[model samples]
Target chain A: METLDGYLDMDLLRFTTAGSVDDGKSTLIGRLMFDTKTIFEDQLESIERTSRQRGDENVNLALLTDGLRSEREQGITIDVAYRYFATPKRKFIIADTPGHIQYTRNMVTGASTANLAIILVDARKGVIEQTCRHSFIASLLRIEHVVLCVNKMDLVDYAQERFEEIVAAFKAFATRLQIKEITFVPISALHGDNVVNRSANMPWYEGPSLLYHLENVYIGPDSNHVDARFPVQWVIRPHSREHHDYRGYAGRVHGGVFRAGDEVVVLPSGFTTRIRSVERFEGPVEEAFSPMSVVIRLEDDIDVSRGDMIAKPNNQPRVEQELDAMFCWFSPERPLEPGRKYLLRHTTRSVRALVREVRYKVDINTLHKEEGDVQLGLNDIGRIHVRTAEPLLYDSYRRNRLTGGFVLVDEGTNRTVGAGMIR
Target chain B: MTQSYQLSHLDQLESEGIFVLRETAAQFERPCILFSGGKDSIVVARLAQKAFWPARPPLTFLHVDTGHNFPETIEFRDRFLGDLGAQLQVALVQDSIDRGRVVEEKGPNASRNGLQTVTLLDALEEGRFDAAVGGARRDEEKARAKERFFSHRDEFGQWDPKNQRPELWNLFNGRKQTGEHFRVFPLSNWTEMDVWQYILREEIPIPALYFAHEREVIEREGVLLAVTEFLTLREEERTERRTVRFRTVGDATCTGAVESAASTLEAVIEEVASARQTERGGRADDRRSEAAMEDRKRQGYF
Candidate 1:
């Protein structure tokens, strides 16, 4: 590969930004694009033209990401919009989602794939209810890295005392959360302060700029490197004359690593096999690790197919028919109730799931457990017990997100009504 | 340093795209690729080829021809499919017009771009296709930025922007009701620069019209339009000879050309890196209004 191709191979960091609509979240994103040179001149001109049409004196940077017709008309982001940018060090994919508390499902949708999250706080307001709600959701979703961006520092005159006060309050509240890493940065998105480049006004604070930190964040060692989890997505059998009797199990490695000649076992069947080779269209790879999609040829033709799993013989995930999980309801049409059956899809496996119990709902704002709640409504979080028709091969969401996460589809409407993280 | 098993951005994207293609095949009963002879869809075809190597692409390539495309593009579409020994299903706008299913537009600046939607929907329903893979990129348009990898549509094949399903991780929910379907875009994250670079790397052959060529063109509304059989010049429209290349291939009547002397893949990449306008900047269809793309998408226009 050439140097440019090597550049193409740079690490990717996906993060989500959550703030109250019009709290400069879009402005910060626009500034990142502008400073990174990701925005084309014509795109800027279009935004400028729309700003003029909207009768704004200053060109509104928020107009750049408010792409939909209704979103521009309402001047608010209603759904999640994905934006891509890159620096020389790493590539970034921002799932810029709406920040309203009512749109909590959108935030979860964005943060589900993120390695980091940015929860913006208005410096003058100082850790409001929406901020707490976002933090709690981030925690519930198992987002490890959280950066509390104290925005609108210009409104507060970039005072060190004010910044410290907000940071202290956020820290006091975040103590109950499950975040593994946290950081703080005071920025003014409208003026591009401490966003891509550090602001001269904040001479007292010595943290790296947002862009620098995003580029340098340590994202490796994030996946479960010790446990190997491979959920078979597809099986390829070329019963051709030349290469007849060739069978391959194809799937993306969710955790750990697998090399050729490694001993492995097929889940559900508990049959043992040795890996023959890991193949891509390019050719056979020396080794395959987490998140790499490859076709593995096993030495033994064990009856391994889609919805089955492959792992080491000694290290195995729990095989259970009944599971308890934290579920976030997404549909506003109906509330979840017991005795209703759903199509539970986990990793590559799909089976009939019967709702056995609705234990309790959690008020994320107060972190209170509301017992005796029989239903999980839209944007509501609750704990429940589900009985599956078949045994699931899984891990805890805290251990491996890919193997532990699943989504619920309403059998009648076929709508994906909720997503669950196995406890 | 330890052997960090992290993939580069391009490799990750390739893996994601291939995974999406295979998922479509494994999930849907009758799925097809919406081939338009454009560079993006050509990349889609290439990715599909690499995805199911040793076995032909599981999905058929369906071309929604507007009958106003560049001759070179049509030829390339046919020749490429022939080379792959794959299937091609062409849905013609003329057939729709002839059958009175859709009426042809009249007067200047009238294009079949919007009319192709009806023909496309009719063909899809006739074929009972449950999923259609396209090459729409998020960076290409504002409306597309909000598109899901597996965009679900109603039974009418209409896209409801407000009620889109939330997609997370690589676990794309391809579940749909019996009549409805999905429009899967494997190139949702790719930009014009990424496509060109991948083309240069994979040695993917595209239509010759993508490179610079001498053609008689006319300027209108600040965009150069290639003179073709379907294009009838106005009284004030005067043709000029110029070394122009197309940034996007579409209806020759609406799709515009840019002045360029470079004809190779490397030159195209260099030009794209320094591009001042988006690839759709030359496209007049989107210039109709601020919400033109959004409105068209709602009506099932790709």
Candidate 2:
């Protein structure tokens, strides 16, 4: 394998930036990109021209990320805007999600793929409802790291007590959520303090700056490397004159380590086979690991198609018909209707599913469970039981986010109505 | 370091995109790709080519011709498809203006950039394409950054940013009702640097306009605009010959260039490395407002 020095050596970290509409999330992202010299000359010129036209004193750094016309006019984010930046230390993908309550589903989408989530809180408006809501959604999505960025410290005269007060309030609230890691930093995104570089204003605070934390945060061991699972996406056969008998199970490895001669079992069918070869785009590799896309040719060709799981013969997932899991309802037109048929997509496999029951609705603000409502509205998180027509190979979402998660599609409309994480 | 036990960033992104493309093809009865002759769409095109290899690309490429594109991009598009033997469908904006589907702006420097959406929607309706593959990366714009990989458009081809489908894991929901279409972005996960790096590594052929060259240009809104027929300089507006190149290509009227001396791809790569503004910052259409791209996207402008 070839590794380039400057760009390739820096690890990639995906982090979502969440804040109330006025908490300066966009400006912070803009500052990061600008300080890192990621912005091009044309973009800077456009921002300057637009700033002069808008009659603003200084170029609105937030305008760099304010991509939608409505969002700029309204001065509020309505969706998740993803921004990317790279420093010498690491590459970053920032999912800039909206702070409004209605856009909680967007936060879920962003957090679903993020390694860390930056929850922004205005220094003046310390620990508001949207802050809790964003944190709850982060925890619900199982995002591992949470960085509480207390932005607009300049508004508070760069006082350490104000930052401490906000941090205490957040820590108290976060205690209820099931988050593994949390960090707090005071920042002024507009003035570029404590974002990319260490701030001299808060001499009392000794922790690293926001950029340093993002760069050095441990995310390399996030994937499940112990339990081997492969959900076959396609059967690759070049099918030409030269390579006639090529049969490769092409899929992204969801967990654990897979070797050339590892004994494997095909799910649902439970047919056993030994992996003959592990191939990537370059050539046949000696070994394949979790999250890598490799085509595996089995010694014996059993009935394997898209959606079928292939794992170690001894470390197989439980094949089950009933699933009890947490789900975030995504559709506005339709609430989750019990006893209705919906397509349940897990990995690459889609199966007909019946929503048997709605266990309870979770309150984002108070962390309380509301019982007996039996209705799951848009952005509503609830526990439900579902029965699939065919058995699904799965693990607990806590164990593996890749295989344990699934999305529910409305059978009639074919719209994705909800996202479920297996229990 | 022990070999990282995970998919490379690009491969992980590619696998997810391929899965989405396949899901879109399997779920939608009629699907097409919105080919803009850009790197983002080109990546999507390549992914489609690889997605269903041995078999021809399952869908057709839909190009909305503003008739103001660089001759090189159009030529590159035709040749690339010819090499793949893939089908190409052209929807002319001038035809839409002639048929009264959309009105052409009237001014010394009026552009058909915004009106192309009407032509594109008309083409989609005419072809009954339920899903249109687009090269829109979320990193381009703020509202776009919030956009899902599978963006659902209403019957009138309007994007509802407030209401989007929840995309979790690698499982993308491409399922939409009749009369509604989806804009699927396989390169949603890629950054601008990543795109350039991939192009450099794969040795992908791009339009010649990307490399810097000296041209008759005028400075407008702080950007060097190529002096073309679509552009009419006022008596006060001065034209000067400057070495410039385009980061993004669109309707020749709206797209602007920056003064650059990077004549080779490697030099251009280094130039991109030190830049501090976004590539879209040069385009006049997005310069209209902060969220210009988002508004255009909501209006079904690809």
Candidate 3:
């Protein structure tokens, strides 16, 4: 939502930055915020004071975004750190996920809701195992755009062939998974090459700079706009009001467009109802679409609460008892065992699910799917067969992220143990 | 006229907050919303209400009481929870002091504000809560702006901002090796202007202190302190009646207000839009030092 006066409405863009530990993910974010003048005066002052206190000749950009006292001390990103900044063109949310193998779960969580992923690679090292792992997770989460930032191009003399080799390598691996859009940009984030402005060294390159790509990327159609899915979050009564008969189903639209008077089918129970009103605090609206939170009133009072999805009757998701899906195990203490039951939460519906079978584990480096062996541990990505107590309405992960993904909660521990995407 | 898309500022903020709340519920073992009946916390409670529909919020409300609060805030808190049928758990600072876990400051201007950490940490330990959802916004303080979405705390309830995890993308690192807690902020993206615009659009219920009213006050540190039972005029200080409104609510001793005629939500939004100073400018505690918020957060302060 942009403001009226021309100041950006902090049109937040959530993107992930991934690379080997030394690729300058933190430094790049720091530079973006610093150069854009997003940092507060006090923050800059403190950083300046701290820099002088540390006896550094120049202010360290990495110290700007790194908050953890430990991460600053150890010089590594251990958890996912979220930082925000805004330019007149757009507001951005940077998810600074870790590059280590042990922190793979952190990358999954960061990319899950991102509109884009910035996969940073060292120009000297080309494409490494961490680069492939980050790219694979981005694709797994259905991130639409990938900007391959060839960092430290200064070290490689800004050679056009080096950028091509890295881009070719990434495309080959990304081909094994579902990746729609990919852009290759050669830059030195440490030396400020093609980050905010076009680089002078890369004479052969002709594309926009990193910031330009981030500002102009087509993210309008990022959310699914084809399938109508609205999971009722609450029943708003607001008693003792002028309109006492108001029974509005409150929820944020997951997919497609919802118009007033449109007929919708409530899931789990095939009850149908006509849309009575689509109300925000601003009163009734003519239509509502994905990512819009509105209270939808229906003609008939259908038994809908949290976990019940409303969708178009004709384009309904498959109601299946058995689900074939890929899941990323998030916990190290527990292993994915067959015949174990978990509280599987899909969209708004929650049901008991058992691990029916283990399919195979995926190898990120070689882009190979290992079949036959079924032991899934922490950060392990594998396919499995799940039988739910109730049938789930789901689409392929590529079709829609909202209705296509689900989290498995451990019954006793209450931790989100795994995340799944329908095959 | 068919408009394809237009997200009201309030709706967008609510959606984003709800998404973060759900992520916390899905990621952490035990998460609780820190409710103080203030506008920020009320917005958080409302977001939690929206996160899990059909079923009441899966978590509970955790209120750390310093035994010195506006009766209106307490009354509003109870009524709000009652309407939603959500559970409420209170942690008393007085109880902690009485139990010798914390020492009450012995002075006329003494507030149990800083001593709240002991009660807060004790409650977390007793409840076994791994995640505590706070209403802190980045614009509130400079140190807060440097905070991550999921700020991790060690076993001793000390926040090591230096060693924080690298959070990239929408992916949150909710992993805790053991005995560690996370302070999850769903409203980290919101600014004071956004909050005001949202309050105006959503028509969220707020305490009376936010709106201007006639009240007796004493001037201190270039601030107009409302004279309540908890606050008294010092020998050197003089009292006066002024029309004032508060930007934030804390211990009656440290919180202050600005003189304004913005009594309605729209007016407040306009006031926030035109104001050049930050919201926390009126807050006395934060003005103590540059690292005030960071120091408090390390001591388990919300």
Candidate 4:
């Protein structure tokens, strides 16, 4: 048996895969899990049975990921399906989404929380419009890392020149994107080349396998640790006889480091106080950082409540009634028009907002901004101006995902109509 | 001083779970945790305690007892709740059957697994719970892989899998119309191995059935089942004593045990790490059909 200590301390990585229906995205995931021995026998057997029922030539690996009955029947993924696997080094969560032009909303949803993206490119097709669009979405979501997986090397004779041509074309288009790091890997998902194991066929290509790169990627600098930000989700007041006056503000740290003695300011009210302590279930901790859920006790409680943000006094988020943001329209029923009202939910705070203006809609294929066509319809990405009824305490979405991202809910239907990133 | 900002996988999962728990508490007027005395629910219970430390969780635990439960699991559940000093409301499948809300299956392979859904939905309606928090993980089944963090149910308590609202980032939408409710799963990202490793790291206590023990069992359709009063045997079937442990805890009729001598948590973790079959492989309930889980989930099954 392996040492339980090593398994307990491993970190986590979340990445999304984007590819056209024929780009073999599902097969690639299947190969990764298969080679890593993560796919259990029962799951494999079920898929194999499915493969036989469908009368496919080979055991269709795509059957493993197309989970829904509709997806299986149509042989296409219509929504985002999350898949999980683990290596000795780290655990991984794959947000698998389809790559159809109509499913852009699903891709955006998948990329929202992803640290990295794997954009698969068919070796024969080189960098197509789908490649550019996937890369653009990854960049728009502020994903730091991207892996340009050149799939189906076997079909192209594992040619180094074909792989280079695709990589060169992708790099040319990616220069227009805001992605930080880009890596290229040549693989054949059907034949399992350089997925989990190094492919002997691609001897000229030198790089870590896809699985190795994923397990070893440096995501340490991904989170913001310079500006302390905590949005209170709930307050715990025991009010019991044993601890009558326990007032604990519970929240997950969005950014920076917070210590017991740090001076903090409450948003919207502008009240200042000192942190008495940061307590988890185990007890009080010396410090807390991004993503850790803790209860913070303030030296002076001045009516801090839900939707209120607690941050360091020295550096605080901007307090604004109007927001400049990039909006991705999700509702197919309605187009975003100026002067329309929406319930803007950001960082636990929900406020009524109006669409002040539609600046421009970006053509996802060409990355061109169309100022004349300001009507943002379904699956359209555009820059819009919004004015809220009350002031919002927020940071640029590029600076912090937790504090800057929001969703627009249509009050009539009570559905999430759109998602936005503050500029 | 420079410090590492990285959190271990367990720490990250725990934080995410706590965040979801807090969100559920703050979003809904009345929320309840669906505790089943299983390992996953046990872990959720522990996370709930930590989420509202020093103060008890504002939500009550609702266990929809199938009436075909392991005696050990019931004892464990009661003791665990007593230690936490939390409130529990049990909705019995027997009550649903007696009240004519649901009918019990009969025959040699009869199980109350399907009957639990009606009882559960009835309980939720009776309690007027706006949100039902569960320990269901996506990695467990194909249908669960597509589940949202806050799964919305319509007025009829049916899940519209094709038309689910898109969930993005850390923001979850819990808004719903009256007579509708949501099923919140905080452990959606946790795999079976992650849960076991977490149990070991946190030293969370689980039922003894999870550890290998000598119990009388009967072999049916190549699966080992505990010999209990709820399980009816045919003339051809015979009971034998075997050392086995359960991977998952559900109704005694449907939940099957694997042959093993792994009594310690460490041994169980080791067994899980090297186990080839999925944890749900022995579960007869899921083996009913290809889309059995999806079908059940649409009808308000947890």
> Worst ten-residue run, lDDT, model 4 chain A?
A1-10
Candidate 4 stretches with Cα past 4 Å from truth are none
Fnat by candidate, in order: 0.55, 0.58, 0.10, 0.84
Give TM per candidate: 0.97, 0.88, 0.78, 0.99
Q: How many angstroms is residue A65 displaced in model 2 relative to the true structure, after the best TM-score fit?
A: 4.0
The sequence of per-residue lDDT tens digits that candidate 1 reaches over residues A1-423 is 364665656788889999877588988999898888888887999989878988998888887788788877777788889898877788788998888877888998898988999999989898888888899988878899999999999999999999999989989999999998899999999999999888999999899999888999888655788898888888876566766777777788889888899999999999998999988878888888877778888998678888999999999999999999998899989888888999988888889999899999888788788988468888888899999999999999988888888898887777788899899
TM-score of candidate 2 to 2 decimals? 0.88
Could you say which candidate leads in lDDT?
4
lDDT of 4 by residue, A1-423 (tens): 457888888889999998868999999998888878889998888889878988999988877888878778887888899999998898999999999888899999999989999999998888999998999999999999999999999999999999998888888998898988999999999999999888999999889989989999898655799989999999999889997999999999999998998999999899999999999989998889988999999999589999999998899999999999998999988898789999999988989999989999999999999996478999999999999999999999999987889999999888899899999
How much is the lDDT of residue A108 in candidate 1?
88
Write one digit per residue (lDDT tens) for candidate 2, span B1-302. Answer: 34666444565666666666766666678899998888778878777766655445778899999998778889999998887768999999999989988888886558889999999999999999999988877777656666777888999999987557667777777767778988888778788777776677667777788988889888877777788877767678888888889998888888889888888767777877776667887788887765577678878988
- True-vs-predicted CA distance for residue A361, candidate 4, Å: 0.4
Summarize candidate 3's per-residue lDDT along B62-155 as a digit string, tens digits. 9999988867778888998888778999999989988999998866567778889899999999999999999998656645655767788888
Candidate 1, Cα interface RMSD: 1.7
Give the Cα error of residue A22 in candidate 3, in Å: 0.9
TM-score for candidate 3, residues paired by index:
0.78
Residues B226-300, candidate 4, lDDT per residue (tens digit)? 999999999999999999999999999989999999999999988998999999999999999999999999998
| Native-to-model Cα distance after best TM-score fit, residue A302 in candidate 3, in Å | 3.8
Winner on lDDT (1 vs 3): 1
| Superior by lDDT: candidate 3 or candidate 4 | 4
Report residue A90 deviation for candidate 1 (angstroms). 2.5
